[model samples]
Target: MHRRQNVRRALLLVSFLLFPVTFYYLSPYLIIMGAGERTASGSMVVFGVMTLTALVLGRLFCGWVCPAGGLTEALFAVQNRKANNRRNWTRWLVWVPWIAVIILVTLRAGGIQRVDILYQTDHGISLTTASGMGPYIIFYAVLALIFVLSLTAGRRGFCHHTCWMAPFMMIGRGVRNTFRLPAVQLSADTPSCVGCYACTSACPMSLEVQAMVLSQRMENSECILCGTCVDVCPHNVIRYEFGRPRSTNPVRPEKP
Candidate 1:
């Protein structure tokens, strides 16, 4: 489990280091700007791919590959407090309006007229080949915001409350759940659980895994399938199960 986390952290760090080349591909604003010009930007393509990926893998991108996620989690040492997951819905406020504007502008521009995977990028690089301090300023401003949110709000605070990209993948996860599609998900062997809250404590998303396991429902929209709960359980009570969700009788815990 530790090795797995190390590998995940390494991948996240690499992704962050490469953000200079990949930023435009994940830029929410770039997508909107592209729509206004009737161009299907790289961000549009990347977001579409993220949504499709979530249909099968959940938010593995956020857990394993997002540069911003990497940057935020790297600061866990400075502030390891768990975020208020109840505020996860707050991101929709940002995503919905941004999506609406993109659609509105796209329609106003007669829809996407062309595909520009390199939209606004100089030879496919975001920072190194930039013309002036504008890109650097925006990049650092974004980093500063992520830094503040992580330090003040808690671990993965940006992910929980402000990520515009998360909603796209979340919607895809919702579709997969609504259709009962076979996909990567956590399964709990409720009877095997020993009531230890290690899984809950280890969860980066701050989900109540112990409670969810006791309830016999491991499916959570916010679950990134990061496998922290699966890895941390001493009794192996939680495990990754990739298949259609099986109906289970709710397991109500006995009173202490």
Candidate 2:
């Protein structure tokens, strides 16, 4: 693995830690910052920094820094090593989060009544509503359930299937090429290639990197660019690059 990739991974982990711990602790209600009321003490500062980070790094924030992504990566890692069965269900399984978020956000915007009476306020919580009765509750339940499923199904099942945020990021990354370069390119030397499927297995998104080695193009835009494959490769045959450039030997700079 390249030193820069390792450094980027470290930076990502650090940033993710700050978000849920420092940032979220300081301001539990995410919308309180700029999304709505300014009750969070350091909400503005944290929000500003996070926004700037996202703007500068683009989808790299999610792939490398986001704690939510970290959870998926961890789950996938466990699933890759321990689980043997591979499920083929794709369509609905992959896009469930996107649909759920759309519905949840729509209801929230529409002023769907929330029942939050049972829940006690955690730190940094300024507002409370009745729970146990609302579209929002359904969203919360679904997200939680999907996360649990991720433990069993493996490879960020919720991220791949239901995260509305994933689809949003994936779309932008796809259109602007803001995230990881698309596709896994195989090195020229075939005999040197040991044909280990570590890259495919390491992928948190469960992408088909082994297959892409032969074709030299990724079929999906859902790749998060965590570089687990790059880290695992012994032969270093699989490399993340902009899809094979027009020129024969296009030199794409490695992502930080």
Candidate 3:
């Protein structure tokens, strides 16, 4: 388990280091900007892929590949507190308007007239081929925001409250759940749980994973399927299960 976590951290760090080259493909603004120009940008393709991936893997990208997530996780050295999960709803505020604008602009442009995967990028690179310091400034500005949010709001705070990209995967996860499609999810053997609560403490998303186990319900939209809970449980009471969920009920922890 420890080794797996080390690998996860290493992947995150690599993703973060590659942010200079990949940032534009993950930029939410670029999608809308592309729509206005009737071009299907790389961001559009990337987001679509995220949504599709979520249908089978459930936000695995956020857990394993997101540059912002990588940055936030690195900031854990400075501030490792769990983010206030109650504020998770705030991300929709950013996503809804942005999605609406994308639809509006795309329609206004009579749909995408071209597929320019390199929209706004210089020959597939984000920062290196830029004309001036504008790309560099934007890149650092984004990193600065993630740095502040992670340190101040807590671990992965940007993911919990401000990520425009999360909603796409979340919506895909939602659809999969609504139809009971087979996918990766956590399964808890309630009888084996010893109530140690280590899983809850170890969860980067701050989910009440211990409580979810006790209640025998593990479905959570915020669950990035990062497997931290699975890896941390001393008794192996939790694990990854790939299949249609046994229960569609929302996780409701029993009253102590």
- Number of clashing pairs per prediction, in order: 0, 11, 0
lDDT of 2 by residue, 64-150 (tens): 766556555545445543322244335346446534553455454553233221123234333234323543454445446556767
* Ranked by lDDT, top first: 1, 3, 2
Task: Look at candidate 2 and tell me the lDDT of residue 238.
Answer: 53
lDDT for model 1 comes to 0.88
CA RMSD of each candidate after superposition:
1.6, 9.1, 2.5
TM match of model 2 to true structure = 0.52
Candidate topping TM-score: 1
TM-score of 3: 0.94
At residue 207, give the lDDT of candidate 2. Answer: 73
**TM, every model:** 0.95, 0.52, 0.94
Candidate 2 off by > 4 Å? 1-16, 19-58, 76-78, 81-143, 177-192, 241-256
Give residue 219's lDDT in candidate 3 (0 to 100).
87
User: What residue pairs clash in candidate 3, if any at all?
Assistant: none
Model 3 agreement with the true structure over 28-94: per-residue lDDT tens digits: 8889899999999999999998899889999888888888889998888889998899989999998
lDDT of 2: 0.48
